[model samples]
Target: MVQNPETIQECIEKARQRLYQIANQYPDLWHPEVIRQSMVLDELINEYNQATRLKKTIKI
Candidate 1:
């Protein structure tokens, strides 16, 4: 299934906000929970990048 770029952007924003909230609660950057949230954000970013790249590469 094709994913909407806008939807992916929204997910990225939500994940980024969640990561920031988690970081604020846990000052330790390496805390497991914080690290987990960071990873989640990273994955969203990667997905967004891939989706956008696919849009650019596809020929009509």
Candidate 2:
């Protein structure tokens, strides 16, 4: 079965939106900690994607 890129992109966007909503809910307590962790996680995800791209390019 073939998957659509647009559908996958939509799913990723929705997940990001949900994460943002959850992060915004702790307005009274630990807000800074939560935001900092979220930023780290986002950075890690970017790094992982870059590594994956490098691996694919190396294989070609």
In terms of lDDT, the best-performing candidate is: 1
User: C-alpha displacement of 15 in model 2, angstroms?
Assistant: 17
lDDT of 1 by residue, 1-60 (tens): 557789989998999999899999999999999999999989888888888888988944
- In the predicted model 2, the residue pairs found to clash are none
lDDT of each residue in 1-60, candidate 2, tens digit only: 223444444555655675677677866436775666566557545655666566678789
TM-score of 2: 0.51
Candidate 2 wrong stretches, greater than 4 Å: 1-30
lDDT of each: 0.89, 0.59
Instruction: Name model 1 segments beyond 4 Å from true.
Output: none
Model 2: worst 10 consecutive residues (lDDT sum): 1-10
Clashes of each: 0, 0
How high is the lDDT of residue 17 in model 2?
72
